[model samples]
Target: MDGTTVTRTPKKAALASFMGSAVEYYDFFVFGSAAALIFPTVFFPDAGNAALVMSFATFAFAYVARPFGAVILGHFGDRIGRQKVLMFTLVLMGAATFLIGCLPSYDAIGWVAPALLVLCRLLQGLSAAGEQAGASSLTLEHAPDDRRSFFTSWTLTGTQGGQILAALVFIPVVALPDDIKYSYGWRIPFWFSALVVVVAYFIRRSLHETPEFEEAKANNEIVKLPLGVLMRDHWKDVLRVICCAFIAAVSTVFGNLAIAYGVLVGLNESITLWLVVAANAVALFTQPMFGMLADRIGRKPVFIYGALSSAVLMPFYLLSMSQDNELLTFALAIATFSFGYAAANAVWPSFYGEMFSTRVRFSGMAIGTQLGFLMAGFAPSIVTGLGGVQEGGWVVTAGFTAVIALIAAISASTARETKDVPTAALGLTTRRAQRVEAATA
Candidate 1:
């Protein structure tokens, strides 16, 4: 090592983002799992079918709070720093999740049971609204220029880790007798999040603000009312990102609603849990590889291919559930989710984060993606209403996933190719193209 050439590792930044996001997502996924598994019976007992819808509805309630949290937290992230916002999101998510674990069930208290759950879910959503954007922006800013996708990919890879942990932790709990499982098994996952919160806090708190943001601040060029600046200067990119983010609905269909459908259609509960665990486990390995590929090839082709392939793959996975073939179902699920969907999942952090400069990246990403994610967060209720996952059903649900994935691919295609462009030249090509046309004239 040359003494004059000091070297620092961006892996530490990636690790911090990864671990913090994993902890935060652990809290979020636990609630989502419980909503599919336990909340329907415990929170809405009056009407059996209505109970499932209500449970999914309560799951969607959090998204209502996400846009507001995005605005408030995005302001702080843009003005103060990303590190502080990341800490705030982690603590808020833990507290809300723990509170959900403590809430009285419908058997103990009637309609109020779900109402209270709604309030806690809202808090969880708010915390989550800022978590991804902050983590991705921080990681992207810290990474070496050529390695932006690789580092920001860790932020999403953390989410796969969290989902894997959530599924693994729930397996034994789901095996407990009905009384114990309902009373304690579900709550165990939520309470465990408190421990993760403590670990994530110490790691996240020590992180330094990104050099890019520091440079912007030192130069007094930070945007005022970043939301406004984002809308005025970058609304087209924001809209494109919103459509791209909507593909997240594929996740809700795969994770939460699939569990309900599997149970409804007679797959073993343990098998269902293992499906999520296995898929996410595969994602843990593949996501980083996909991200590195994005760094080399471009974010667009990888993401587009992922979206379109998932559209084709969803039917196979959904149809597999109707048969008694556990092994085949598992393979199809892993193929669709880990290899196909994970491509878009790994690429999007850099793909989206690169669309803006550091000055307003958080607000631009948070508001746009959260608003689009509102559709994803509510997909369970929507699909259920459509009878997409009804008994002896795969057509409606398959079509739903296919349509959303197609929209995402189209949205991605419309955006300018951004592979070799530096962070400084994110959304200026249209203007530059116009200038070239004028010069030719």
Candidate 2:
């Protein structure tokens, strides 16, 4: 391919990204749902009152593995190619999820069960650390400059799709008798991931590497050490992305923590799952619209609006669940999550991907977001441990949500708008680009 004349495959890239992310997160969210609704009984049967907390900790273990996975996978993704690395991540996640399904429960394995669960969860985290960063970078590079957000938004829309699928699958599982639900029903979701993985693997395999990465390779601009370059040249942006990524915690608060809280407050387990299903189903449509809005206005405004709106609306959403009004709770769930948090979710792929050049975009986005996502991964356990899942614990959850949202919004306010920036010229302010060129010359 000519360095200056690379073919963009925006639609193909978007479709591949969507399928890969949907599959990857489908596996991931299955684990999340299981942790909340099933794992305590199956894996931590002896922990008594601590079983739920331990299960949530197992959920947090993936976040712990994510940063390390980010470094290792991000390097290969930036060095070799996003498409290849994404293929690897899909397979790794599928294998781990499948193995989780195969693991013996605590009754059969004693302490070994939860330990194995954590190990599989770690592998899931490692795979996830790279999935979004690689997918977003690939899609954004393949996109037309003016429609970057809209195309990249599909990557995250895939996540909403996955969550919806996970919830839908789990709803039936949660409805089974306790013996059956615990013994076999829960494993079906994990096993189902294998089929989805095969489907995503073929779809992603058919797609080519992004044009920007191809152009960079053609011009010999591919860095020998993407992480070194990322940190030395883009540290400020990395830090900014880390803080802005805090907004992701809002998602965990809604998806996982709130589920436990809802059940504690007398909502049916299936109804809580339906809340997740409804909210994410709405996000499937709204996020793409938010992406278009960002394209028209700018990423920062949309992102900041998402952050502040989530903070303001979260308390009401949580409080409604306690009011015995399922209709009101569902409405608030849609408002807070689909309309509020989904804006940030849809935009972050582009917002963060634009903060670095093609050479280090993968590493920068993977590392920063993974590190920030530690907050998200732990939000359920941390909040629950702090009594957020107890009676009247919505206050703790709401306060935690507000703090993270404020931090994200404030961080986003300081970012330069990149909606108008050319794809090739992204991550390069004129002065910095000149400095880099001068250093190379």
Candidate 3:
């Protein structure tokens, strides 16, 4: 190793980001699993389909909080630093999730149970508002110049880990007799977040700030209002990111809503959970390979292909789930998620993060993506209202899925190809780009 080289820093940064994201999403996914499998029964036993809609609404409530959380968290993340903001997000998510485990059910507390659940979901939303953006920004800045996508991919890969863990846990809990499952099996997952949070917090806290942030601070380039600079100089890119992020709705549709849809269509609860586990487990390996492909080719083709392919394949996956053929459903789940959508999932960290300068990268990614994710947060409820989970229900959701994917692909198409751009010169303003070009010349 070279004398001045901090050789282990990149690996450490990726590990920290990965671990932090895993814990954050683990708590988030726990709530998602419960919303589908447990909330309708435990929190609103008497309302019938209205109860399911209401339960999904509580799930969507976090998304409503997300954009707002993004603005506040993004501000501090950009100004105060990504590391501190991420630590706060981790702790906030844990507290909210733990409280959820303690909340009483509708049988005991009526509407108050769901209301409190919504409140905790809002806190989770706020914490999630910054998790991906902060982790991606920190990882992207720390990574080797030529391998940004491969390294930053771990941040999102951690999310797959979280989802997989969430599903694996809910699998057993969902299988218990209803008396036990509803009584306490569900709460176990939420309470377990306390342990995961403690582990993630220590790992994240020990990580040093990225060198890019330090350089910006030393040069007095760090702005007091990163949002202002981001708006003034990078509004177009922000909008692009927002549209592209709509692709996230596909994920929510697949991982969260599909569980309910499976149960509604008569698949066993554990089977649905297994579908999630299978897709995400395959994604754990496929995502990094997609990341490597992004680095070798470019972010554009891989992301665009992923977006379009997931749209094309989602209908089949949903339709397969509605059928009696469990084998076909499982196969479609892997093909749709692992090979198709995972392409976009694996690459967006670098694709989005590279669009801004370090001074506001966190805010830009956080605010933009959170705004777009509103569609995701509300998708299950919206599609459920549209009869998305009923027999022959694949059409409504399939259409919704395609439109969002088109929006993302179109948005991605508008951006300049950025694989060749250096990390420091990324997201340059007109003047900044000219200055960089002249310096190179």
C-alpha lDDT of candidate 2 relative to the true structure: 0.93
Q: For model 3, give the 10-residue run with minimal summed lDDT.
A: 1-10
**Model 2 vs. true fold: TM:** 0.97
Model 2: per-residue Cα lDDT over 1-441, one tens digit each: 453676789999999999999999999999999998899999986554478899999999999999999999999999999999999999999999999999999999899999999999999999999999999999999998899999999999999889999999999999999989989889999999999999899899999888888878988889999999999989999999999999999988998999988998999999999999999999989999999999999999999999999999999999998899999999999999999999999999999999899999999999999999999999998998899999889999999999999999999999889897777777886886666556544
lDDT string, candidate 1, 1-441, tens digits: 122232334787899999999998988888888888888877887555577888898999988899999899998899999988999999999999999989988889888988999999999999999999999999888887678898899999999899989999889988999989888778888889899899989988888888777777877878778988888888988999999998888888899888888887888888899999999999988999998999898899999988998899988998888799999999999999998999999989899888876778999888888988988888998888888658755777788889999999999998776666655455445676456346544
Q: What overall lDDT, based on C-alpha atoms, would model 1 receive against the true structure?
A: 0.87
List TM-score per model, in order.
Answer: 0.95, 0.97, 0.96
In order, the Cα lDDT scores of the candidates are 0.87, 0.93, 0.90
* Candidate 3 segments exceeding 4 Å error: 1-8, 434-441
Question: For candidate 3, what is the TM-score?
Answer: 0.96
Superpose all Cα atoms of candidate 1 onto the true structure and report the RMSD in Å to 1 decimal: 4.0
**Model 3: per-residue Cα lDDT over 8-98, one tens digit each:** 3778889999999999999998888898878989999666668888888999999999989998999998888889999999999999999
Model 1's TM-score against the true structure: 0.95
Worst 10 residues of 2 by lDDT: 432-441
Q: On a 0 to 100 scale, what is the lDDT of residue 354 in model 1?
A: 82
Q: Judged by lDDT relative to the true structure, which candidate is superior, 2 or 3?
A: 2
